[model samples]
Target: MDGNKALIAYETKGGATEEAAQKIAEILRSKYQLEVDLVDLKEQKMPDLSQYRNLVIGGGVRAGRVYDKVLKFLENDLSGKRVAFFVSSAQAGTPGSYEKAKIKFVENTLAKYPKINPVATEAFGGRIKILGKTVTDNRDMVKVEAWAEELGKKFTQ
Candidate 1:
């Protein structure tokens, strides 16, 4: 839809997921001329879904599940909207456990979305820095970027 509004909400542990969110927002903006709202989940309110026709959420996956805010957003009434989710984690591999984890998250959400369904969903690999104050662990920018690009396409679609 022309002139449709898109919102991308994100929760970042060390900034990687925030980057992914921005990347997806950029993709949506560049290709569709849509207004994109990038919200930091930590500080923002619960979000009113009635304002926008399209929405995207990205957050860091720690331990297993992603940030709590993103999770809450998922439970909202999405109904007939176009929506997607992207996550950043240390488990990214060339079809390894991390990929499995993301896929599972996607599948489960999709299956459940019929109850509160969106138009689509996506998951992107995230990074962690092994030695930094604000970030540490395993940093995989390449993997994250690849997913971000793909996610961009998905959002546009």
Candidate 2:
């Protein structure tokens, strides 16, 4: 609700996207001294976009696409906002699949919202498990924190 505040709205099917959102929020709050609000998209309550100076929307990759709630949230008016986009996917950590993941998750979202120019767009590593067996565990806290720090610089400047 303050100009120095940031809102990180995320859509998560599992918990990887939520983990990324929390990491971003922690970085912004501790390192950048910004008040942050972490909102789950399924909560059904959207914050007033004009209230915060920074907005970060992210979600996990499902079937090679971002969550529908995330897409719907982006459909709102985002003019005059310092926005950032991030996505969590196992493909993000795979050398051969990283670019494709970025295209599918980040670039495609940009294509949909041509009017909104994000300050930063990132594709972070994510974890996935089936039947309690790890399929991939690529979630990297360092990368996520660095991206959030970059976002802090963008918002502050």
Candidate 3:
């Protein structure tokens, strides 16, 4: 693994996951001085993972489950990589339900894949729309940026 290379791969339904992935990639590149590659798992084939020292995977949640693409991606052998995971969910954005959402969406989900030991993980708020009208906008970019900053430090360390 190249110590300075990182990959941010994600799947998004309502665009929240992709937005978070972009923010993370930006921070890793600009602040950490890392070579970052952003991949939309829905649109592109998975790149060769051997080139990256840090791997950040994320997806949006709906109906109490993380996106299928991200789950499938997690099936890869991610040993010896600095892995980080995140999810975007409406429940996570709610103050009262944040912990439950993290457990169900991030912790419990990652538990199924024993080989993946993430250096960091988080659950961010999501957005919901109905017929092109915004209904719930719970995304917090500041929180996302803060997580990325911490993740950058972990990756470099």
TM per candidate comes to 0.75, 0.94, 0.98
* Candidate 2 lDDT by residue in tens digits, 36-155: 989999985887778888899998887878899999989888888899999998898887888989988899878988988898999988888898788889888888888988998887
Candidate 3 runs further than 4 Å off = none
lDDT of each: 0.66, 0.88, 0.95
Backbone clash total for model 1 is: 6
Give per-residue CA lDDT, model 1, range 1-157, as digits (tens): 3227778888898788887677767766786667788899898775566877777777777777777777776777776666766666666432457658666665554565456554445565555565664343455555555654654565556
lDDT minimum window of 10 residues, candidate 3:
44-53
After TM-score superposition, the amount by which residue 56's alpha carbon in candidate 1 deviates from its true location, in angstroms, is 0.6
Candidate 3 global lDDT: 0.95
Name the weakest run of 10 consecutive residues (lDDT summed) in model 1.
Answer: 133-142
Question: Candidate 3: which pairs clash?
Answer: none
lDDT of 3 by residue, 34-88 (tens): 9999999999988899998899999999999999999999999999999999999
For each of the candidates, give the backbone clash count.
6, 0, 0
- Highest-lDDT candidate: 3
